[model samples]
Target: MSYGKKEFRKRLLILTVLISLSFLVLLGRLWVLEIIQGEKYLFLARNNSIRLLPSRAPRGIIYDRKGEILARSRPSFSITIYPWNLSQEDLAETVKEISPIIGVKEERIYQTIEESQSPFNNIPLKEDVDLKTATKILERKLSLAGVDLQVQPRRYYPDEELLAPVLGYLGEIDKDQLQALRGRGYRLGDRVGRDGVERVYDEYLKGEDGGWQIRVNNRGQRVGTMGHKEPLPGNDLVLTIDRQLQQVAWDSLKGRPGAIVVLDPNNGEILSLVSAPAYDPNLFAGSLSQEKWLSLKGDPLHPLTNRAIQGEYPPGSAFKVITTIAALERGIASRDKSFFCSGTFPFKDRVFKCWKEEGCGTLNLKEAIIHSCNVYFYQLGLETGVDNIVDFSKEFGLGKASGIDLVEEKKGLLPHRRWRKESLSRKWFDGDTINLSIGQGYLLVTPLQMANLIGAIANGGRLYRPYLVKRIISPEGETIRETRPRLIKEVILKKKNLDLLRESLFGVVNEKGPSGRRTGTGWRAKIEGIEVAGKTGTAENPLGEDHAWFIGFAPYREPKIALAILVEHGGMGGKAAAPIAKRIFEAYFNSKVGEKKSRKVEE
Candidate 1:
């Protein structure tokens, strides 16, 4: 009995030690939870009770130089569901009830909820909801336990297709963009700029989004407002574009496949820019339908393309100006140098034919430019050589991007001997030089580049960087930034040479029946009150008819506007493009006169 008592006491002592160790372990875990990991657990617990809801700030408004609104925001309603607040059965019931009303599939709603990154955050079931549907959802709020109607700002374009390419459009941030931008406070449902000025200046246009903390019950229903922060609106942009001039340029295209660019030669301020086959940007304001999106993407005309800076084509006879500058600069040709054109140029074994079959007899440099004599330029190019031509073309901003503020600008091709040897694996030949001299073979330029080049000539050899936005204003009406005229380069030329070239260009438009011809090539560009100097080009295209081109500046003396027009597959520049230039010049000068009269009246 004594031994049994001893063994029982020993077992009891062991059991007591085991119980103490278990209690100590429990106390250790409790300390870790209450102290070491306290903040984390506390945050998780707070999140369960208080939900942070993000609110989108209004995007900046875009305006023309005259303060006309181009882009703004409108109040829109959206239906969203808080997945964490609803049980599986409640979510099913809500989806069944709201799907038919919202015109969305029940499966889609369920998928949205399932794919949501955060169950506590609201998942948008349907955006851009109609008022009647929103009213119905509100009335049935008790039945739809986790669903709520929220008002948000949606982008709205006033003029629609008028400024579609320049203003661009916004869409929901994609997964990749979300991943890249999440650290910057961007969310899945946030809209982001996709093209043009919107994409380029998104940082300034996208305002800081705000958020609200609200106390919620276990059911995910808001019980009270805990805290809130107001969203900061984005800054406004004032463009140098004149709405009237933009409209005129768009209208002058006349639904043709072409582009027109007008600029203030002195300041590089873009007055008007238009690319044909434009689409309504409003189509992208809301969720674009698959059919509509496909139609635009599949259209053969490529309406989405901004052709002014993107299209690459041979400048044709318009490039003669560069050739002339090259020759004059190299002292290979002069205003008095004469070349006889017998309708064809014989280089080695091949003969290149001129457009004028009978040949333009004996012609001086100025007369050649006026008549667009191919043979004359061919000789001049041979004399100037390929290297000199390429150098001068580069100096004229040809075969290069004009550094416009727009995106996707193509640097046109300027073929040289090295490029030929490397790219084509062939030595540069005389035929190649002759062809490039006339801007026919392997030489290409964007209309923007041509406009900038002409702008340089009109502004006395000063090349300015083409810019669209003139100023940026803060929400509080303070000037945040203003764009000043930026000179890019200077074309070094004697004043006499420029004057001579300018005079020759003036004759191409103003002088008629010169050199015993019926009319000058650019005679159709003449305006009664405006003395316009211009160049006409018929670019040969391998696919179809020649592309028409015209580059010019108005009021030959103290020119203010420099313009470039391109029409795809148009027959002749003199016949097709020059006439368009005349109309634009007329409208521009007429508007200037009216503005002057208005100012006088005010005075």
Candidate 2:
């Protein structure tokens, strides 16, 4: 019994020592954490309760030259997930719970989470959510952990389709863009400009994004902001476009499958540019559905195409202006030299017939221009030769991109001896020259190039590099940059020849032909009080009706505005395209009168 009691005492002593040592160790750990390392752990605990939420800065406001708002950002709600705060199973449950409320599929949400490079970063689950849906998410905040509601900026175009082609639309940054721009602070799912000026000036328009350190309760509800960095709004853009004139030009198209470009002849400032079959840019403000995207992609009219710069079509009779320039400058045809048009001109094996089968008899250079005599030009083209024709054409900015500050600018086909040899492995023929002289046979020009061409003629042969943006203003209203008139080249036409050409173009609009029974080809473009000088063109398309073209400058002598109008498959330039020019001219002159009257009243 004594031995057993001794053994039990020994065991009890061992238990007491072990227990005492454990208590001592616990006391030392508590002291260290409460005193020496207290601030560090406290900061860590506070950080666990604090969440960093991104505050999207609104993109710059786009304004017309008249101070009219074209595009701006509006506040919208978005839901995001903090991956670090949730495990895989937790995320699945949270996604499933919020899927029906946000109208996003569980699979998509999971895929988004999976694509995230870091668990510490926030993943966007749904963007641009409605107020009703956002309220639902907030109401279920207690049940939905790691999900956050944020207010972000959504791009909006008040004019919608009226300026879609120029203003463009925004879309999420793709893999390639993200990879290229990641170092520049661009992240996945960032809204980037997909086309138009948006793409061109994205660097200026996009602002610095800011964020807030928000404190949340156990239920994932916001308590207070620990700290925040205020978002800096993007710079503002002032375009050279005149909203009133832009509206007039757009209205003139009237849903036709064509384009219209209006510019200041003295400068390269684009006043109004319109492409028909426009789509609403507002459709892209939110997450575009597959159905909507497919519909836009599948449309036959291709509403997304900016016809002003992208659509390449034969200039039709517009090429006559270039041919006339080549003829007079190269000494191939004199102003008084008359050519007899016998309704058709036979070249080698092929015969080319004029539009007027009866014929334009004994027409001089000026007379032929007014009449748009195809036979007269056919003879002139052969004499001037294709080389000189191509040279003069390039000098006038044809067969190449205009270097306009827009994307997708196509360099129109400028066929020559080398191009013929290399592209078709064929020799140049007289038939080809006859066709080229009349703006037919593989000759293509964009509407922008035509506008630039006419602007050069109006401004006395000085070709200016066409520009759209007039000024870029900072958010604080300071001018960051301003655009000046940039002269590309001068055609250096003879004063006498230029004067006669101008007069002939004036006659094309204002004067009747030698045959009083018929007016000039551009007669329909005549305004009551304004003297307009322009030429008309009919591009023959074997596939369909001929494309109509009319390029002109208004106020004849002291030209202010120049226009290039194209009506695809619209039979005649005078009938289809010239009338549109008349309306646009009337609108511009009327607006100018109204502005003067308003200024007088102010004075």
Candidate 3:
């Protein structure tokens, strides 16, 4: 019994020490919580009690070459409400009151009210409301308890109709865009470029979007900004596209349905590209009213497409340039060789007719081109064979895209024995070659491609990759990168060969006979002292009448500009298309050398 009592006393003493040590450890932990780790826990606890959200950053602005605002962001006042917070009666009452002020019906508000869930705050449906409505709602704050007023940036285009297709426009974020941008930092409600240059330079123009850690009270009112990261503005672009020239081209084709492309012959910078009957872009950005949207949508003229790059047409006689060069290279014809034209050339089964009955008799290469003799090219195609012409045509960037930065550019039809068998499932024949020789049948090309072809000839057989963006200006206004002049291809031809070709082309403007248009067909195109060299075309189409075409260059010795004009159902190139090119040339020279106000380009 004595030993048991002694054991119990010893155990009791150990238990007392153990309890005292545990108490000391607990006190130390308490001290650490109150001192060393206090701030972190305090923040965490405060976060639990308060609701936090994110606010998107401001979007960047766009400027034209002359620092004129093309696209800009303006502060928009929007009203929002937490649909989950209100009772059915309160929600119905709120909807009724909001309907009269916002011009929204009670049905829409009720639908919005029912669609919301209670726990997660549902986003409100209102956007771009005025400040006056918001002020009135704030005065009646009790009636609009869960409502929110947000100031956000909305995009604006100054010259909405002038550059609708090229400048493009922006729109609210879509589901597909959100899915694609999963790891790319885009969020809901962000504005994205939909088309045109806006789509092309999106990365440089979007800038870095930042966010704010906003703390809100129980009623959804903002208490304070917990954290924020300021956004960086997007870089500006300085395009080779001249605003004045663009306007001139746009105004020139106001009522006419045609396409025009003016390019710098030195480098492939596009000075102006105009497709007539364009729709205003401002109609797209807003909540387009039914009547206003219908006004443009119902029009027969497809104002949406960019015809300069998209429209395809046969080159007609203008394509003779290809045939002439091919003939020279294939040893089928020499510069001094002459072909007798009795108004036409009869092939295996087809008769290709010339413009006049007298035709051109025993005409040399210069006269052949000047008169645009179908007999000359037709016989040449038969002599050199189709394979050689196809090979040479591809060399000049035909039957392919010119690699312009526009979207959906079609690689034109370049026909050969192999291409015919694969695409049409038919055997190649002599008849096919004859048509292809004269730039008909399966041969198709865009105006842009033809313009680049002209540029290649003007710059001594070096093809340049045509482009519009001259340079990209950084946020700090420094040039990020400059576009270098590129020699895409050097056509296998001697300088003398190129010169000989130029001389004949010059005769088209200076000489008489079939190529003579200055007398009547295109009398109005003549300008004083400019020395313009050009070719006219009339391409026949199964869908409609012939597509009128004119391609030319000026200051003949030192070529400066190259352009192509196509007027759908418009008459002969010499009569219709050539005059437009002449007018555009007149405008350019008038503005630059003449030191006078540029004249309006005429069709």
Candidate 4:
């Protein structure tokens, strides 16, 4: 009996120890679950069966001068697929089913399904699809594996007819852009701004995209909205252009190819920049048809080119003003500095003839510019010398870029001794300087440069850098920054010399004297009651027809507006380009708004 009791007590002790150890393990597991990995496990548990959804931010709006909507976004349907939620076996069937319905190849679908990584709810099948097509896809029950349809926003151009080139176009994000913005919260399918306002203000234009998480089935379906970061809407852009003026400029082009640059002489704000052969930028929002893209790309007029800033041409006689400035500053020519114009200058085995067959005898500096005398400047150029001419030209913002707030601005050619030697492998000569004086032979400049030059002369010999953006505003319409009327440089010439040159420019419009002979089209084209001072240009193009240019400032007493008009392959500058200027002037001064706000032109 004693031995049995001892064995029983030992068994009881062992049992008691086993029970205590089991309780300890249960407590340890509870502690770990409650403290160490509670949140992580909870997230994992929900995520295993839930779907994370992303809400794309709405794009910004573009408004013109009068608060008219130029560009906006509209609702559309996008087809997407979730790669992580679907099984690898289902990927193949998904491809087979989606291919026939969407007319997409099964191979491409399979590749996307097989290659995608991470928890992505949107695997785009076709973005920017038509609403009708979207409805058909949904009703057809052609739902490919892992595919879901959702609402997507796309860009729309309301006034595409008015502004096209100024707005520019957007295109697909290639590997280059993708690589640049790889992990900076921008993904492969994000539609970035490719050009114009979109490209210039891409960060502000593309608002932050947001998302949420929800419990989903193993079949990869959205069950509910989880954690959401609401996407911030992009700021609306308000431009500095009058819609009426823009429309008139567009209508005036009348199918001929040309460019117009209009700016406020006081602040150098680009009021309007018009390029002909423009197209609706809406064509680029989605998948552009191959035919439409080819037509636009191969258009004869090169509609895509912003000619105001990019096109380079010889300034012709229009360059005489720069020559005059150089002459005045160098003391090579003065108000009464006389040089005979025999209509032609003798070159090496070549004689260049002036447009006016009649010779100009003993012309003063002012008279020389008024008559567009070729020989006078030819003689003045020799006195000024090539080096001095180049130096003075640099002071007026020639040979260098204006640093305008746009893309692809050309630095027009102003060849010097070094440029001639480096580029042409030839030495500079006297003939080159003479040619440069007349704005010919390697002295090319864009219309913007011409306008800026005129603006400088009008604003007391001080050059201001040209800019398109006057200021940028925040979403709440608060000015983030305002541009000041900045002057770049001033040419230090005797006041008398500056006065004489200004008087000569005034003669071109106000006086019909012997000095101001109507040689180019600018003579016949003049607006009544408006004393517009201008210079006409006709440049010989090596590739095609001659390029005609006209640059001037209006209401000569106090210069308020400066404009540059360029017509490619058109006739004389005075006839072809001057009429365009007349229309632009009419649009400005005749408008009731302008007349009411017409401030006296300041000297």
Candidate 5:
């Protein structure tokens, strides 16, 4: 009887200990569920019942110096899908139902969903969808689980083709770009600047994005709005471009394949920048079609290229100004020194023929420039030597970028003896010097560089860095950033030399022949009231016809506008390029006159 009582008490003690331990285990699990792991589970539960949709902030508006709208954003609808909210079977069915309505293939929608970074994140299946299609998608929202009709801001370019190259275009962020920009809050399907001013100021132009959390039912339909955050619009950009002047420059091109750049000689502000054969930037506002993209990429004219900053061509006789400066500065030649051209210059084993086969008789520096005489420059090049010419050219910002605000500015080739030896493994010959003297045979320059070079001369040798943007304004109308005129360098040249060159250029447009008719090659560029000084060039091309060129500054006494014009395969500079310059000058002066009269009337 004593042993049985002892055994029963031991059993009761063991059972009591087991029950207490079970209570402790339950309490530990309750602490973990309500404390340590509670927030994570709560978030998961909320996420499953509620959808968080991101709202893209409207991009900054782009305006010209005159406050004319260039680019803005408009409300547009897009079809988006959340992969995590729906089961695999439901997601496939949703894509099938909406793909046909939105005119997108079901396979493409499935691929986009599969390639999305996270199931919780919304992937844009089709952007910039029309109202009719969006309405249809919403009407069947009950059946299409996890599919959302989202209103997004779409980029709009008002100036269209007139400012295509300058304004650039927007494109969706791809996988490669996402890796670099993900930390910056850039998500997949986000539109970013692809080129031009848009690209240069992307950070300032992109606004802060917001998000919305809304309650949803078990059927994947939004039931009630829970929370919302308004998006902040981006800052505004005011460019130095004048829309009127830009139009004039574009009109001057007239479907030609070339570029024209105009600058404010006083401040280095880009007044007009036009690259011909331009396309409408609005074509890229939405999802660009593969066929349209291929057409643009494959077009022979390459209308998309910003030729003003990228096209490198031989400056031809327009480069004679540099040669003349080098010759005079090096004391190899004087303004009064005369060269006799008997139609052709005889050198070792070959004869370099002048453009005028009949030969221009004895001519001095000033007269040679006015007549565009090749033989005169040929002799000057030979006397100046290649090294001296290269040195002088570098001082004028040649063989390097002009440091403009735009990207992809090509540093044109300025070949010297060392470069020839290193690049071609050949000895520099006297013939090479002669070719270099006339602005041919490996010497190349972009239209922007040539314009800046001429602008320096027009502004008394002060080279200013070319700029496009004038100021950036915030949404509160506060100036965030303003660009000031930046002086790049002052070209070292005697006042007398610059004056003499300036006078000779004036005669190039104003001088008349013995018959009282204009004889200068660039006489066609002469404005009636404005004293214009200019140079003309006919660049030789092995592939096709000669490229025509003209570089000039208007109102000779107080130069304001400086221009560089190029016409690819457009024949002589005087006949083709100079006329375009003349039209631009006329339009500019006439507009100034009109403005002055209007101001007087207001007074």
Candidate 6:
């Protein structure tokens, strides 16, 4: 407790050194935090209060050929929360108060905020909320901190289920999609195209998104806008589709489980495409319920399936056209050559019977096609062989993808000798050839393929790749891209043979037989003033009634519209499918005439 003067001086100096070292340590730590990690800490400090809020851009306007709008976007309201601005107590209170009004559980709201990777960014609590609910939240804004109402662009399909399979729909981005698209500015809770043209042209349809840097108070109430950017609208799509023709085709189906395709034969421009039992794309504009999703997946008819390109079926008597082509091209059968039929043909150990029990008696190549005689084709197919038939079918773009500008197109089954050995582990038999000749065996084709086949026949052996989109226009009304007729292949055949075949097809619709006792199979599709050529098919089905089909092109000399119509579980192609084709042709020609008259009046 007592010290001399020298001892006191020594203690004071030691105290001074210890104080200086403590200050030096403090200065070193401050230098590291401020100089070494200054930018990182500065960003963290700015993000704590100032946040970037994204503004959704409106999707492009989808238009028919005549400039009729099919799809557009409308303004909608959504509820969001800023978890970074709220304490634990404030967040709980906010969730509890708004949960009942928004029809969401408080636990879900809490879980959504807690699971977010970017708590600084606003998280949507409920999307596409009704105006009444939004109004209630606005009225209680002071009581609910960190809860805000914002406007978002929501997709709207004006025609509802009419063009769903073609236009597709939008959905929230999943984890996989976000990971794949993150580099392209996609983030959590972003919406993207799911299928159809929407998925195919997403880059052109999805415009640039805008955003704002806004300053918010502790309660998450926006106090000031630091910066803002306006969003750009997506480009417009001009499709080759004719809205009136589409309506007519849909009505002809009458909500059946089938498809109808109408296109320009010379150019492959699709005028109408209808797939029945379609779902509403509007249902997917907002959040879809799990129960409804499961119901759609479990439906027996599969409304989600695009029957035009995806459905594969036996082509029935329609295969006779291919058989006839093969026979003529290979010089196996002449135009006047005839075969006798007594209802059935016995080959090996089996008897293949004609559809008509009484039989077609005697018929030539043209008569056989017009009458759709099974026994006549059975004999012709045996003579022509399977290899020739397959080669001709491929030339006509059958048993392969039609190269259409659409998704999920199926290359139908084209059976040959090797296919049977590989798939069924059996030898190719005469019975198989007989069945294939009538389009009743392993040979499968889509309605789209049948339509394309008829188109090639009508266009004089030039196979054009079918296309739905004609042009893409910018938002300022400038044409950015236009699609022309793309010729896929041109079959090499004698002009006389093609002309004779065309004449025979013309008879199948207009010509009467044996003093009007029996008409050609496609006579029901006949138009009084227009020359139409078509074929009929009745595909066999073990589970139910046979599937009916008709393929036709009108104004036979200079054809305008080619069509393929199918009716699932509908008996007789002439009775069920031919009438529908007639109606479609009528509507199409009538519209053309109306356009001409309007142009004349304007002139």
TM-score of each: 0.90, 0.89, 0.82, 0.82, 0.91, 0.92
lDDT of 3 by residue, 366-406 (tens): 77777777787777788888888888788889888887766
Q: Score candidate 5 by TM-score against the native.
A: 0.91
Compose the digit string of candidate 4's lDDT tens values, residues 1-603. Answer: 999999999999999999999999999999999899687667555665766667777777776666777777787777777765467787667766667666678787666556654334456766776677667667744435456667766888877745775566667677788888877656766777776677776666677787676655665555556577877767677666666777777776777788878887777777777877677788888777789888878987777777777888888888888888787787777677887778887878878777778787777777777777788888888888888878877888888789776777898988899999999999998889888888899998888888888877776777877765545566677766666667777767678876777777777655575675554336644788888888878877788888887888877878888888888887678778878888888888888555565653331
| lDDT measured at residue 280 in model 2 versus the true structure, 0 to 100 | 91
lDDT of every model, 2 decimals = 0.87, 0.89, 0.74, 0.75, 0.89, 0.88
Better of 5 and 6 by TM-score: 6
Considering only N, C-alpha and C atoms within 3 Å, which residue pairs clash in candidate 2? 317-537
Candidate 4 vs candidate 6: which has greater lDDT? 6
**What C-alpha lDDT does candidate 2 achieve relative to the native structure?**
0.89
Best candidate, TM-score:
6
Question: In model 4, which runs have C-alpha deviations exceeding 4 angstroms?
Answer: 1-48, 87-121, 138-145, 174-184, 214-219, 288-300, 358-363, 513-521, 592-603
Look at candidate 3 and give me any clashing residue pairs.
Answer: 521-575
Distance from true location, Cα of 14 in model 5, Å? 31
Sorting all predicted structures by lDDT, with the top scorer first, yields 5, 2, 6, 1, 4, 3
Q: Candidate 6: where is the Cα deviation over 4 Å?
A: 1-44, 115-118, 514-518
Give residue 20's error in model 5 in angstroms: 27
Better of 3 and 6 by TM-score: 6
Poorly placed runs, candidate 1 (over 4 Å): 1-49, 174-188, 216-219, 289-294, 514-518
Tell me the deviation in Å of residue 426 in model 2.
0.9
Give me the candidate number with maximum lDDT.
5
TM-score of 1: 0.90
